[model samples]
Target: MDSLRHHPIRFHVTHWSDDPFSRGAYSSLLPGGTPEHRRSLGEVLDGKLVLAGEACNPVAPAMTHGAWNDGLRAARIAIEAGARRVLVIGAGFAGLAAARHLREAGIECVVLEARDRLGGRVHSIALGPVWVDEGAAWLQQFNDNPLAIHARQLGLPLRETDFGQPLAAAADGTLPDIDAAWEALRAGIDRSLPLADGVARYLESRDEAVRRATRFALDANLILEACLPLESLSVDALDEEGVGAGDRFLPQGYSQLVAHLAEGLDIRLNRPATAIDWSGDQVRVADESADFCICTVPIGVLRDIHFNPPLPPAQQNALDHLGMGQLEKVVLQFDERWWPVSPSGYLRWYDTPASFGEWLDLTDAVGTPTVAGLIAADALERVFAGRSDEEIALVACEALQAWADALRRL
Candidate 1:
């Protein structure tokens, strides 16, 4: 603590909730909502209008690769429909991917993006000399991940996350039994109840200290993982089919991949599709009409844009049931590295609800003295409710120094 000097040089925080383009980071399966709702969003509407994004992908709904793959899937469907011209809304990975492939397949395509730049949730910003990814930084599940292949082929500098590395537990080295809560989850609980309610069934009987540790585990693992308020998440929110293999991080920022996918494409920036009229043979977005249109906007943004003849009642109901989650990040850039550097692992600081969930030791990842902290779940907004970005960053510096001081005492 005594050795720690100089405040952070600068900081950058994400405002997913404030962005009109993307209402939230990703989709969160709320209580009483089934996975079918996610599938329903991906369904094609009369073969003229198809949706593409991570939200539309049932396999890996929140993954960047999922959006990329689904965009290609949607584009192929549009191409098969004998469409000569296509309109792709939103410039995210899905929309860009769809537009690029459609153009290459002898189809005229124009991309409309609400944002000023490319890469929706896969945003990367320069922090001093190093570039830091604000969202979707990692190519997790590297063994089977398509993005990993792209990174390797491009010769982009990559860092494999050592998932096997043991996390630094509490200062006392005591950890809670989070397995029991997970066991209860696997034992088949009521799906109608919220995730917090389901987890309470088992942890409610434990002591305060144990319960605190267990709560930390839930906040860090499940709540933050789902990026939703525990009270709103479904019991099966974390349910998975197969375990993803190794995870990888891009040292050159994810924007390079976005740029590569977006090369030589006719992309119109700062354009938001006000309405989609798919009623006629030729689909239309306002006055601009195309043979087919692929709407890759986020589910929340879907509620904002008007659709002529309206969407299917079933799809509307399903989308209404699903929730958009908040996952924000702040990159604290310092003059020099003061935090402990590890070979490869997350530096976790335990707290109630875990406002700053976990941090990536960017010293090794980006060759800069920076640590990116993820603020997510219900506590996401609470921490940044009325504070400016600088205020929030200052608070984070305190949190980091506290953790450092704690370690020094040990």
Candidate 2:
């Protein structure tokens, strides 16, 4: 907290579990990522069952907008098929979008969510006077993003923040120039010559000085932004899933977009569809049977679901190949702001590859003395595995202290 000049009073750690409803945070592609898997995932089974989620989206899979688009597509397919009653499972962004569009088209649809509340991954909690998003927080593409469009329409003010700026430097104070090295990396990737397996492998081929200098930033981007480990992320897929120029946060909370999308839709919470009997003419979910059904659950959760006739071998294989990304956030509320106030945010460590390496300055964003520490991939798994909230917080504080010490030395 010394780097930020803030003394934290309380800390809240949110660890999203790989469970019945949401197995992980989002979807990630493996090496040799193919669009065929996504296409197979989105295929309408027997014109009675349709899969709708970010995972089912071929163009923008694992994105909030992609999920919304998939929902729209699924709803349109059911409507065009003259389906009167549609069962939309999981009231996440995709399910909510499908329900909303289905309602607009005057098609009867019921949204069944396992959780008691809506906004699957887009969760927000109040920390004193300000609200902090514990789940999906930022809208990446701003003007062009579908979520941003809905936020603007709902009159939610967006706090635009440039994440490119760094608040703290490396302890050695010999940070390498990333722009030139990044260009070289991109050029190497463009050649499509058998580059190494992952980002870490590709970086290994670079000069020692260049690798050391770019290590911190590059690792941070992979884990924090991509929500995957460098070892698991494919070099080719990295370029394919490019980063957004700027990010916008909903001060009111990202759930507002969910609320807007869910307006007038029949959303039934606390109803987890355990079994689906889609073998006959009518698609059955729980006790209710509809002309068609849209399963918008995450791929991790889908693996466990019981299908009457079972999913096709190709679809099952696709689910097995696609991996879920893990991410955990630790939100700390301080008595006062002790850190430098930056319009964007703070990137703490230069060498740490863990999630806590980057801390978002929520002090200005939420009008409170609070910051969120992120952890993802293998680091998150190792640090948080079998650890309590208190233990996690202690580790996070120690990391912050270490970062503060480094800043002081510089």
Candidate 3:
């Protein structure tokens, strides 16, 4: 980890979080990424270079493991073509995976990350007795996932989550029966999944009834997801993309796993790739170095960086059309354990994003009376767009208080 220094020192490291080179960690599509932009980005810029990042993965985007897989996949293509001096831009999972693959294949590679440490959004902060994940935390489906396999092979500990049953409460002095609500919600999701999948296939085929049928299935899935409302998302979008319904919690945190995956690699911390000079045969990176470079920077970073020739009008337009899913998780701590013990978790409706979380019990799992998390998206701009953590917490407390009062009455 080095301070911001262009004045060449013993170890001058600078993170992209602050550096102008890379604006952020991973690329988040901001309602501007158009289909054409994605197509153009995937085109390989005249066949010499390839793009790799979480955004590139359609199924599991924005996850550490997916980015690593993308990097490895890209590297395999590069190596097959006999790339000698390969340069990996970004030191997170993507860069680390690319470096590992290249090194294992006997190819010379160097990873450059615009951060002090490797793990991008997979950050871990010290909580109480153990370091809990402040960022990505979860291992969903250990059966076929590569990360789970690696974790098992390395003998790392795994923790199973208690997602079997969750609590339910209302804001208006009424609490719903937990067992019944969960059963209904679970059944709803099971019935809606196949319908949603069929809708997607229908939409892809351009059926005349696609519009209405897609809406029906999507609306149903939204109820299952316990979103603010079913109408917030577009039917087409819902059919095209499904939510991460099968999520599992990881005790060690995704960042720890990233660190483990990043050991023994040539990562240049804090060096952001400001301007990519891709005008020549050898892709010139960072406005100077001429060599084949792998751009693993997130899409959000691209929104700010200046592409040497300026991204094409089509690409720029596509960037403008693409949108990022709204997803945020907040953890809260309560003074007293007011939540009921039976399948403890709550889902409530709120006017703001901060109020989305009903209640969750972390007493047994995390060993704290913390309320755990409030997961929501889309409503973010309206709820927490400009609010402070204290303000958000106050809103959460108020919501929880309302829920508690309702429970007591019941």
Residue 14 alpha-carbon offset, candidate 1, angstroms: 1.8
| Candidate 2 residue-wise lDDT at 322 | 75
C-alpha lDDT of candidate 3 relative to the true structure: 0.53
lDDT of 3 by residue, 3-41 (tens): 211111111111223334333333343322322344455
| Model 3 RMSD, rounded to 1 decimal | 10.2
lDDT of candidate 2 over 113-181, digit per residue (tens): 999889888888887788888787888666667877777777887877676676665655655665565
Looking at candidate 1, what is the lDDT of residue 127?
86
Task: List where candidate 2 sits over 4 angstroms from the true fold.
Answer: 1-7, 189-205, 240-243, 346-348
Candidate number of the best TM-score: 1
Say which candidate scores most in lDDT.
1
Tell me the TM-score of each prediction against the true structure.
Answer: 0.92, 0.91, 0.71
Error of 3 at 4 (Å): 44
List per-prediction Cα lDDT, in the order shown: 0.78, 0.75, 0.53
| lDDT agreement of model 1 with the native | 0.78
- Window of ten residues with lowest summed lDDT in model 2: 190-199
lDDT of 1 by residue, 102-181 (tens): 98898999998888999988888888899999888888677767878878899999877664452444434455555564
Per TM-score, what order, best first? Answer: 1, 2, 3
Give the TM-score (vs. native) of candidate 1: 0.92
Give Cα distance to truth, residue 298, candidate 1, Å.
Answer: 1.2
